[model samples]
Target: MKRYAIIVAGGKGERMSSNLPKQFIQLRGIPLLMHTIKVFYDYDSLIQLIIVLPANQISLWKKLCNEHNFTIPHEIVQGGETRFASVKNGLVAIKEKCIIAVHDGVRPLVNRQTLENCFSTAEHYGTAVPVYAIVDSLRKTENNTNFAVERNQYCIVQTPQVFQSSILKIAYNQTYEERFTDDATVVESLGIELNLVEGNRDNIKVTTPPDLKIAEVLLSEREAIIS
Candidate 1:
C-alpha cells in the first residue's frame, strides 16, 4: 500500500520561549522534526514525507538540513495560519490516492510498532488515531477549580493519525471552522469513525520548555543505555 506522511511544523514556538521554531530545536543533537521524520523512515525507508514548514522559515529549514547532513527525499509545503490549513496544503501537494498519515513534527519519539499498527489498521479502516488511555485521576474544572468525572472513558490522543487519501482530501475541502481540533475531528464530520490504535507513552509532543528538557533526558538515557 502506498503510504505518505505530512509532518506539521509550522508553529512559531512562542510557548517555548525560543527565537527558533520548536521543531527545529535539537534533541540528542538532531532537529526535533528530523527525529520525528526518521522514525517513519526507519520503519519503512520508502514511505514518502512532506514537511509543512512556516512560510517565513522555509529557507531556514533548508539551511538546517544542509548543516546537519540530513538527507531523505521529501517535499516541502508552506504552512498556513492554522494547522488545518497547513495540512490541507500538504494534502494538495500529494498526487496519489493512498493512506496519508498526519504527524506532529514535535513528537519525535513515536516508535515503529505504533506506526505499524496505525497503518495496519488504516488499511482496513478509513481512519485511525493513536491514543493512550488516561491514567491520571479524573478532573473536571470550572474557574480553575477541580470537579470529578469518570476517567475510564478518556484517552489522550496522539499522532500520526492515518487516513485514506481520498477521505482526507474531502475532509479538508470542507469550510474551515475553529472547532476542528485535529484532522481526525475534521474527517469524522464526514461520517467516518476513527479507529484507535495503542500509542507510546513516550511519544510526547514538544510544546513547552519543560517538554524539551524531558525529551533531552529521555534521549540521553537511551543513548547511555545503548552505549
Candidate 2:
C-alpha cells in the first residue's frame, strides 16, 4: 500500500517572540520545516509528502527551498483558517486510498522508529497516535479552583497521527467543533477509539527559543552518531 504524510504548518511565532514563523526558524543552518520533511523522506523515500501552508506563506517557502538547495519532492497545498480546516484541505488533496499521517511542522524530531510504530499500527488497527508517559503531577481546574488528579491516567500526545486514508477521510467529513484539538480528537468524534504507541522522548515540538537551542543540540548529536 502507498504511504502519505500531511505536514501542517500555520504557526505565527507568537510564543517564540520572533517575527518569523516557528516553522521557518533555523534549527541548524536550514529552515526547521526542511528537517521535518526530511525525516519522513528518510523513513520511506517513496512516501508521498503533502505540505499544508497558508496561501501567503507559499512563496516564502518556495524561496527558502531555492536558497537552501533543498530538493525533496512534495506537494504543497493552501491551508484553511484553522488547523482542522487545514487538515481537511490536506485530506482533499489525497486522491488515492493509502495510509495517511498528519504531523506537526514544528516537530522535526520524530524518529523513524516512531514513524514505523505509527504507520504499521495504523495499517493494522485503523488509527494510531504517538504518546509519551506524563512524568509530572496532574491537576484539574474548575471555576476559580484547582485540584490534583491521577498523574498515571494521562499521557502527552504527539503526532504523526496515522490512519487508513478511508477512515480519515470519512472522519474529516463532519462539521468542525472547538473540541477537535488534533487529528486524533477529530477522528474520535466519530466514536472510534484511538490506538496509542510509545513516542520517542526526544520528539519535542519546537515553539520557543530554548526549544530551538535544544533541538539543534539533539540533531547535532544524531548527525555525529550517524556519520
Scored by TM-score, the top model is 2
Provide the TM-score for each candidate, comma-separated. 0.95, 0.98
Return the lDDT, model 2, position 152.
Answer: 87
* Structure candidate 1, residue pairs in collision: none
lDDT of 2 by residue, 108-212 (tens): 999999999999999999999999999989889999999999988999999999999999999999999999999999999899999999899889999999999
Model 2 weakest 10-residue run by lDDT: 19-28
Count of backbone clashes for each model? 0, 0
- Residue lDDT tens for model 1, 39-59: 889888999999999888899
With candidate 2 superimposed using the best TM-score fit, by how many Å does residue 169's alpha carbon deviate from the native? 0.4
Q: What's the CA error at residue 84 for candidate 1, in Å?
A: 0.8
Q: In model 2, which runs have C-alpha deviations exceeding 4 angstroms?
A: none
